[model samples]
Target: MLWKYLLGFYMLLVTAAAFLYAPPALGLGELSRIIFFHVPVAWVGCLAYLVSMLNSIAFLRKQKLEYDRRAAFNAEIGLVFTILATVTGAIFSRYTWGEYWSWEPRQTSIFVLLLIYGAYFVLRSAIEDEEKRARLASVYSILAFISVPFLVFIIPRIYSHLHPNPIINPGKQMEMDARMFRVFLASLAGFTGIYAWFHNLHSRYLKLKAKFEEAEKHA
Candidate 1:
């Protein structure tokens, strides 16, 4: 019940912030409104992957099914957010870059991430042995997380074409407008909260399903 109220509150806050704060942050009057969804989606994608990596490490160390379940849930959620990010990015590109489907380095990296995780799920389903499935999935999760930084950041920097460089370079003083930073932070927090709530719900459901299956087997 408390979780429900918290979820509702977070949803309301996010919706309100999206409407009231997003416009001025993007600085395009009305057309820049999509930042409300775009930024949050991208932020959540990274958050999800971080969670997956942590859970993967836990699973590898403890060899617990619960950790495996959590890792799988995090990966699934990450994939969803990644897809959202890709779609929103394409929309932004169409508006700003005048092309919806460019072979830009960043875009290609994101597409590769989508494919990698898509195969991750496929690999999980192809395995029937519970322990083997967990082991394989954990290995994949760690490998994928290890590759994410290179795919998303290092590659883009080493061979940049049209992607924008990071604002704060090494030892470079940087400043963001107060309003824009506030909006960006709020979007990040809201999206993270949503991911937490969803992850909790997913974990609970998986436990309950497992309990039910175990009871049936004994009966």
Candidate 2:
């Protein structure tokens, strides 16, 4: 409980730092501030998918329904955050590119990612048997994650595009101001913390739900 309050306060500080502490990019002016939130949320989405894929592998290895449940929950969270990233990115594009969406390589790749994950839920819904659904979804989750790296990172870079260069590109030294970079790191940490808090709460809820369902089935 106390930690939740602390997290809330910390996020407030991150928000303030994004607006007040970080200087504008060389040409982007005020719009550059969006990167602090946009990049972190996108990163959290990618993290969620990675977690889901790991759990999917665990389920396949151990044949545990619990692992499948965790994978599904993580995938759901990933989808939601991916959507949020898309919307925020579109907002950024609206001002910077003079259009809401231009079907740039970056935009197209993320759209494909959304469609791929969206199909995961559809595949789940189409199956009626619990074990079979879990098995198939786990397999699909594993396969789907194989494309995440390509769609999110590789493909976007492979084509000519208008997206800004990433702050921490592996091949290049970071050119951002020290203070701005610090705030960006803080924002990333804060957003990841929020994802962890939410995931814990969601896992507890899944546990309680399973318990209730089991009780009713035996009653």
Candidate 3:
């Protein structure tokens, strides 16, 4: 309970920092403020997908429904974050590139990633048997994650686009303003805490739901 309030307050501070504390970039001006939210959400989205894949692997090894449930919940959260990242990126692009979306490499790659995860849910729904669904979904999720690095890290860099240089430039050095970097790190920590909280809440809810369903079956 106390942690929840702390996280809320911390995120509020991060939001205030994005707009009020961080200075505008030379090229992007006020629009650059979006980075605090955009980059962290994107990072969280990737982290969620990675967690989903790891849980999927665990389920494959142990054949436990618990792991499957965790995998599914993480994938769902990842999908939501991915959508948020895409929308934010589109808004940024609309202002900076004069279009909401031009099918550039960055946009195109994320779109493809969205489709890949979107299919995971569809596959789960189409299967009737719980064990079969979990097994197949686990396999599919593992395969889908294989594309994440290529789509997010490689493709964006391989092609020329209007996207600005990341905080870590090609030389792999931090080129961000000191103040901006501090807020950026704070934002990342805040977002990651939010993800951990969400994952815990979701996992608990699923456990309760499963118990309720079992009781109903027994009754």
Candidate 4:
């Protein structure tokens, strides 16, 4: 219930900020303004996947059904954010790179990640045994998680492309001004808060679902 309230508040704040603060931060002239939403979504997507991977590991170690549910919920949320990130990134590319998409390594890796996790859900659906399903899903999640770093960092470094280099990298020129930074940070914080709220909701839903299934079997 607290999470629900927090989510509602965060969403309202984000919507207000998007209208009131975001435009000025985009230089009000550059299309790079999309980064306000794009960067935050991408960051949250990666963060969600990391949490999913960690939960997968925990499930494997503890054999707890709750961990499995957390992993699944995180992965689902991660997928949604990733899709938003990809689409927003494409829009940015069309404006900046003069194309809708390039065969950039980072982009390719993101696509692969999306496909892998999509397959994970398929695998879960095909399995009939609950224990077996959890075990297999956990394994696949770990493997996918291992690949994320390579996709996000390693592969992107090996090639030259129009995609911006990592912001935290030293010696990389930052194109953003101070005002843009403020709005960007705000968007990120707001989105992250929303993600946390959703994660709690999804985990609770999973727990309740498990309980319902258990009770049904007994009845």
Candidate 5:
């Protein structure tokens, strides 16, 4: 309960900090405020996919349905966040670049990435047998995740981006203002907590569904 309160408080703090304390960057003006929300969700989405991949690996090795549920649910979460990230990034683009979207490397790669996971859901729905579905979905999640690092990290570098510079850059040793950075870090923590909460609930729900189906079959 305290953790829930902390999560809500964290979000409120980030919203306030995004609007009030995180001053507009030199070039982008107030539109840069979207960073507090957009980046965190996108980061969480990417993280979820990575977890899905690991779960898939476990499922394949152990043939356990629980791992499949994990992989499936996290992929669903990842897709939702990816959609949010795309929409928010589009809004940020419209304000800064005068277009909703373009063939910019970052946007292109992300769009392609979305398609890859979009196919995952479609694939899951198309399959009928529960155990079979889990196996194939696990395979798909693994392959999809293998491509993710390239989509998120490498493609942006290969093609030039209309996206703005990152708040912190390791190679360039760059960073955002101290105040802005602190709020950004808080936003990340809050969203990560939100992800954990949803993940647990979703996983439990799936397990319950399986149990109910088993009871019904016996009856």
Candidate 6:
């Protein structure tokens, strides 16, 4: 698909830019390089959660099984990305701060998000009725997404922590230099393509699954 080609090219370009073009930060040195990877993964994870929330809202409004499937799959992908962000963040923190798992505000917020959505899958598995599962999962997804903003934006500001300045400042400022900015955006675009590729593949799988189940029931 087009996404596959885009993702491939993006990967190659970002790899080159990350290793070659992106300059080290004034203080962070080579460690600043992690931001190119970390920020995009974190951003896409949030994007997936937002998509899940939108689909959840659609399910509630339309009472459609398809919408619920979209919600579930997207949330699942979001949870995976959140985990990647957390792990990578911790690793980066380790190199920069001398340890992992300091229970920093940012780390704690993402950890909470992970638990919230991890329970989403659990709740679905615990329920046996298809319609009931969809209904409750939709509700839970909305509730889980409600905390995303608080965890991501509010917590970081509330606590005095070691995390560096944000890319976008509260007053709509850009924090990065020209060289860093270019690679950061490229990595973000590439990661987004990766998200679309996975989402489309998973969505198709869900459709095939429903069809197969329907055919089996008739047989």
TM-score of every model? Answer: 0.83, 0.92, 0.92, 0.84, 0.90, 0.90
Top candidate, metric lDDT: 3
Candidate 4 accuracy as TM-score: 0.84
lDDT of 4 by residue, 117-154 (tens): 79889999999887888899999988877876767677
lDDT of each: 0.77, 0.88, 0.89, 0.79, 0.84, 0.87
lDDT by residue (tens digit), candidate 2, 2-41 = 9989999999999999999899988899998998999888
Candidate 3 at residue 105, lDDT?
82
Residue by residue across 139-200, what tens digits does model 1's lDDT show? Answer: 98788778877776766566547644343368875444465556667777778878888888
Over 4 Å off, model 2: 149-158, 214-219
lDDT digits (tens) for residues 1-219 of candidate 6: 776886898799898899899898888898888888888888888899889889989999999989988888888888888989998999998998899987778788778878888898899999999899999999998887776776778776776698886787887767788899989988998888889889989988988999999999999
Q: For model 2, where is the 10-residue window of minimal lDDT?
A: 150-159
Writing each residue's lDDT as its tens digit, candidate 5 over 11-81 gives: 88888988998877667677777888999988988888888889989999999988888888888899899
For model 4, what is the alpha-carbon lDDT of residue 81? 94
Give all candidate RMSDs, comma-separated. Answer: 2.8, 2.0, 2.0, 2.8, 2.1, 2.0
Give Cα distance to truth, residue 92, candidate 4, Å.
1.4
The per-residue C-alpha lDDT of model 1 at residue 67 equals 87
lDDT of 3: 0.89
Give the per-residue lDDT of model 3 (tens digit) for 13-125.
99999899999988889998998999888888889988999999999999999999899899899899999999999999999999999787867877876897889999999
Q: What is the lDDT of residue 132 in candidate 5?
A: 97
Q: What does candidate 6 score on TM?
A: 0.90
Clashes of 5: 0
